[model samples]
Target: MLDGTLDGRAWRLNDRYRHHAASEVLRRAVGDPDLGRVALVSSFGAESVVLLHMVSVVAPGLPVLFIDTQMLFAETLDYQRAVTARLGLTDVRVIRAGADRIAARDPDGSLHRVDPDACCDLRKTVPLEQALAGFDAWITGRKRFQGGQRATLDFFEPEPPTRLRVNPLAHWRPQDVQDYMIENNLPRHPLIAKGYPSIGCAPCTSAVAPGEDPRAGRWRGRDKTECGIHFIGGRMSRRKVTA
Candidate 1:
C-alpha cells in the first residue's frame, strides 16, 4: 500500500538531513511540519538512553511510545521507571496488548517457547501498530552498525500503508553510542552488565559471550533476527526508495 508520495518524501528528508548530527536530526524531526505528529518509539534497552536523552533536551514533551511486552525482565521495568523520571519525559506512553487478547492468544505465556514470532506479534507488533495509529511518524534508535538489513539504513524511511520511520542514529557507530552515554552520564539497561547486549523479551533473550555479535543473545538458537515489528509480511523489507 506504499505510494510514490511517501517514498519521495522519505528520500528528500534523507538527502536533506542524512549528514546532520543525531541531535540535529532529532531536533529538526520534532519541529518538521512535514513529519506531522512524530513520536519516539523506544525499548529503553541497551543504548536507548542516548536517544531518550537527546529527545529530552530537544523536546521533553514529545510523545514517547514504550511497548511493554509484559515478558520483559524485572530490571527492564525498573529501569524504564528510573529513566523516565530522570529524563522528565512528560508524555511517555506505555503500550501493551489487552488482557483479553493475551488470554485468548497466549494464556499460558508459553507462546514464546513454541513460536517466538507469534509471541512477538501478540505482545509487540500488534500492540505497537495500534498505538502508532495516531501518529504520522515515529522515531527509532536503530543504527547501521547493527548490520543485517540495517546496514544501509538511512535517516528516513517509509513504513508502508501509512507512516514514516525516522532513524536519527542510522549513521552512528557503536563508539558514538558509548561516548554519548558516558559523556551524558546516562544509565544503561541493568541487564547489559549481565552480558545481554540486546535485550528483548525475557524468554527469548540470553547472555552473549565475548567475540559474538552483540545481538547474538536474542532468540539465541533461532533463524530469526528481527522481532516482527520491523518486518513486513514475514520478510525483511529492504526497499530503499531513493531518488
Candidate 2:
C-alpha cells in the first residue's frame, strides 16, 4: 500500500529507533549535510504539544508551519497561540487557505460538506504543500496508534517531487504523549474535555464513546476521518486526506 519507506519495505521502522529518539532523529535530519532547509508542522491538537515542545528544544528557531484551515475549532486556535507562547517557540508561521480560492470555490465555506477531500485539498493540503515546498525535509508528530490507515507508521518517508519527511514520534504510545504533555505543562485544547478526543475542523469533529479509538470522533460515521493535510507529509498524511 505505502511506498518510499526506509531500509525496510514494510511500514514499521526497526527497534533501533531508540527510546525518546525523536530528538536524535531531528538532529540528524536537520543537521544533514546533504538536506537543505528544514521545518516542522503542527496542528496544536490534543497531543500536538508534545512534538511542538520537543521541536522547541531541538530547533527553537526552525520554521514551524501551522495550517489554519480557517475551519478549525476555537479551542484549537487558542491552543495554537498559547502553546507557541508558552514554549517560547520562534519562527512560527501560520498558513491559511487563499481567500480568493475559497471565494471562487466554496464562496460560503460549506465546501467541506459537499466534497471533504477537495475541501481539504484547498483548506489544508494545497496550502501546506505550498509552504513546505520551501524546505528540503519536514518533521511531523505522527504515531502508530491513530488507526484507520495508520496502524503502522514510519520514522522517515520520501516526499515526492523532492524532499524527505521525518516522523519524530512514530513509536510513541498515546500515554507516552500524554505524559510528555503533562510533564511539560503544555496547554491542552479546550475541546479535549468536551469528548472531542481528537480535534480537527469544527464541523467534522465530535465526541467519541468510552473505549472508542482516539480518532473515532472525527468525521464520525462518514468514513472520512482524515483531513487530508497530513497525508502528503506525515501526521496528516495517512490520517487525513490529500492529493
TM-score of each: 0.94, 0.85
Clashing pairs counted in every model: 0, 8
Q: Which ten residues in a row have the lowest lDDT in candidate 1?
A: 234-243
Q: Candidate 2: list runs displaced more than 4 Å.
A: 1-20, 232-243
Tell me the tens digit of each residue's lDDT in model 2 across 34-148: 4468898888888888778877887889899999989988878888898899888989999997789899988987887888877887888878888886787688877787765
Enumerate residue pairs that collide in model 1. none
What is candidate 2's CA lDDT for residue 19?
Answer: 51
Would you list the C-alpha lDDT of every candidate in the order shown?
0.88, 0.75
User: In model 2, which range of ten residues has the least summed lDDT?
Assistant: 6-15
lDDT of 1 by residue, 1-243 (tens): 433588887987888887799899999988887688999999999888999999999999999999999999999899999999999999999999999999999999999999887888778877888888888899999999999888988889888766899999999989999999989999989899999999988989999999999999999899999987776445533233221
Q: Predict model 2's lDDT versus the native.
A: 0.75
